[model samples]
Target: MRTLTTRAKVAWAVITVVVLVWALLPVVSIIATSFKLPSQLNLGTFWPKTWTTTNYEQIFAGSAKDLFLPALRNSIGISLIATFVAVVLATLAAYAIARLDFRGKKLILTTALGVSIFPVISIVTPLFNLWRNIGLYDTWLGLIIPYLSLTLPISIWTLAAFFRQIPWELEQAAQVDGATSWQAFRKAIVPLAAPGVFTTALIAFFIAWNDFVYGISLTSTSAARPVPAALAFFTGASQFEEPTGAISAAAVVVTIPVVILVLLFQRQIVSGLTQGAVKG
Candidate 1:
């Protein structure tokens, strides 16, 4: 294999650094803004002249607490439920697609791809009306169902690809030993598919968590409104007080969990997306 020359390596390093800065600059700015006192927001500085936790307090315990807290709970509950359901359903469907030599397998995969790429905006209006008529509006189930639309297709695709890479012989061996089909899948296939399932679960969770379009259109009251949607309801204490700092603080609060999840599972995510099970 040809090794990278010193000059080429240096060039690659520079490009990497530049890309990192470009990607992280906005996030850093948001974090800094979250710590800034509202009074210093328009001071023409990249960071606050004097930092304070007043904004954080506003969201956690002060005026915005009622809105932020409930929304936060709704977001966590809805996203987790969506991820679990999507992963479970996707795992079963993908296994069938990969393991069975049935007709319409290609059609199933293609339909999932199409739904995953479909424009979400086009469907929101219809969903809004249908949800209201069907009495799903402003409810957790309402949001979870829409979230499945956003998460399920990609999940099916990801797990299907991963399942195809898994050797079927392991499952056969288990069955040969008198294990039932479910037993073979649960004991043999599931253990090997863990990394991929975990990665897909994370992806589904993130999709549901960050969704603003569905969250905004489907819900109204804080009873079911998620953080992404509740942010739109944020108001200043008075005409003079700006809500920028509070909004930034809330953004940071919601973002931390996602960052932590990525940090904890970075290895599994890379493994799932980039590698398949080793074949003998």
Candidate 2:
């Protein structure tokens, strides 16, 4: 590699600093506001002289009826269940698409891709009616099914791409050793596809977690609503009276788990994304 000139190096450093600050500004602001007292927030300062965790305390103490903890629990439960179901279903479907030769295989793949691209709003009304008729409305199962609909297509496509990267020779050797196709898939293919599966699960989890429209539209009771929808309760009709500090504090708390998960699995995400791109 050619060495950079002093001027170029200086310019590169400035650009990097600018990009870093741009990326982190919102996060920094959220954190700063989380610690500020309610009175000091609208003053618009980078740092607050008086800091308090009273907002967080009220939330944890269960004093705030509109607090996010219950919503957080609901979000976590729905996201985990949805991700699990989506991953399993997608994995099996991807295996068949990738490894089996059958009529309409191309059509199946195309349909899955088509489903992935379709606007979610188009299906919401019908899905809501269906759930209501089936007596599944406002239930975890109801949410899980819709969440799966949102996540499944992408999960199938991503896993199918990753599955194509696996060497067929391994499966062939396992077959020669008297292993059935299902056994070979379980023993060999699944192990090799762990990273891709993990990435798909995480993506699906985040999608389910972040969804506000469907959660709010489909679920009427606070018991079933997730964090994103629950956060909307913090807003008032009048802008001037909104609890910006409490809202920001709740947001900070809500975002922490996701941040921790992403940081923990950063390597797996990078590996899986690159593997899918290069191999597929």
Top-lDDT candidate index: 1
TM-score attained by model 1: 0.90
lDDT of 1 by residue, 127-158 (tens): 99999999999999999998998889878888
lDDT by residue for model 2 over 32-115, one digit each (tens)?
Answer: 887887667778798776888966765666345454777778888998999999999999988898889888878877787787
The C-alpha TM-scores of every prediction are 0.90, 0.87
What is the C-alpha RMSD, rounded to one decimal, of candidate 1?
3.2
Q: How large is the C-alpha RMSD of every model relative to the true structure? A: 3.2, 3.1
**What is the Cα-based lDDT of residue 266 in candidate 1?**
89
How many angstroms is residue 115 displaced in model 2 relative to the true structure, after the best TM-score fit?
1.7
TM-score between model 2 and native: 0.87
Give lDDT: candidate 2, residue 24. Answer: 79
Q: How accurate locally, in lDDT, is each candidate?
A: 0.89, 0.79
In terms of lDDT, model 1 sits at 0.89
In model 1, what lDDT does residue 31 have? Answer: 94
